[model samples]
Target: MTRQRVSLRQELPLLVWLVIVWGALWQDFSPGNLLFGALIAVVVARLLYLPPVELGGRFNVLRAIPFALGFLAKVVAASFQVLFLAVVRGPRVISAVVAVPLRSRSDLLVTATGHVISLIPGSVVVEVDRSTSTLYIHGINVRDADDADKLRKEVRETEAGLIRIMGTKAELSALNQEVGA
Candidate 1:
């Protein structure tokens, strides 16, 4: 098999990202640093044997706005809740692991859902079952069945939001079918 030639247009983003990272690492934005960074980025981009990652689906920035805001809200709210539970009412906290059945079967959607859920302070992704498209989330202050169900619902909602923002049309159709939306 013959090697594919790399195009400048294709490598442009990667080169720019590497240069930014290098400048940040040195804590200097001087022209000299930028030039050095560019040189390094060029070498790395050429020598690095990293495989191309296929990011499937279209990204809708407009749809993602609400999701981003919701994520921030969840993070802030969960932070306060965790703080209250840990500081104000220490030692009485109850935690449980919940299994959430995800609607989207795409790996990108599943991984993004897990990462977003885990970013909130009161919950974390303990395990992911790709075969079943299920996420085992460990949640703080889970008292009983009702609490577990609530957490599961929250994860489902987050997954739905993520699907709307970045999921394929097929995934969206599947989600709509599942939820009757």
Candidate 2:
């Protein structure tokens, strides 16, 4: 398949993120190291024939700040919950694999939601149906139908939060409409 040529402007975010990750991995953010990382980032981006990742061309830092904080809080809470479950429930903890259908069809939104859900200690995304934008999340301590429904709600809520943070305008509008309804 012929790949559409992506402009440097369109690809800048990926290149910049790659450089930051490279610097972080090496634990060296010195100018020389960052420059080297940037050089490698550009080379990898250019050499790889991956499809372009389309961004929304906008990001809401205000929205992201709260989302990030909430995510951190969830991580902490889930970590303790997992530890408690392991100690208390031991071998009898109930777990379920639940399918969550997300509102956004964008691959980025789906992937981001999956990561957020998996980052929480008690749950991990086992599979993704990209065509349907559905996530199969395996969650520990989900003992009943109510728990499964709750998980699905949380997954969709995460996607909604992401849509608020960096989704395309149309997606944002759709989310607003859904909430409004």
Candidate 3:
């Protein structure tokens, strides 16, 4: 009983989430649904708390909104560019996978980098080497070395800014130093 009390205190958010879920279910309150929802919520809450990567921090989520918007714009522009290249150049356009170095150390940051690149129209994350912190991206219409380099730069810059906003102080400092070096 004492141990349960202490653990519950440490996981107050989970308790609050349980209460919210119970209240919602209780209103309509089907017995089967209530049991299922409670079971699922308990499992999810336990999983959320067990992760070694601390998700809580004093960070600005609002900053990420602009980053997402900018990324969306870039995706749209790239889509149109790819369409134009496909229609105008046909079989002559070159596509190649280029390896990109990532500065952020967090798994979340790295996953976000891959996801964002994959979301872009003319680009896809073809491979990721987590051990080396590198991403291999396939770029459509990558005319030459210059175009590939430019694409890599743009992806790095965008990911760097997002990482700065989302990452912990230690991570942000390391990432900044890596980018600088």
Top candidate when judged by lDDT against the true structure: 2
Span of ten consecutive residues with least summed lDDT in model 1: 49-58
State the TM-score for model 3: 0.69
lDDT for each residue of candidate 3 in 59-160, tens digit (9 for 90 to 100):
566877888798889788878988898799988888989999887666877888888878775688988899888999999888799989988987887677
Q: Candidate 1's error at 38, in angstroms?
A: 6.3
In the range 1-181, model 2's lDDT, one tens digit per residue, is: 5678899998899989999999999999999999999999989998986888778878999999999999999999998998899899999999999988888888888888889989875779999899988899999999999999888888888888999999999999998988999
Ranking by TM-score: 2, 1, 3
**Candidate 1 deviant stretches above 4 angstroms:** 1-46
Candidate lDDT (C-alpha), each = 0.84, 0.90, 0.75
Better of 1 and 2 by lDDT: 2
CA lDDT, candidate 1, residue 94 = 84
TM-score for each of the candidates? 0.77, 0.89, 0.69
Let me know the TM-score candidate 1 reaches against the reference structure. 0.77
Model 3 has an lDDT value of 0.75
Q: Arrange candidates, best lDDT first.
A: 2, 1, 3
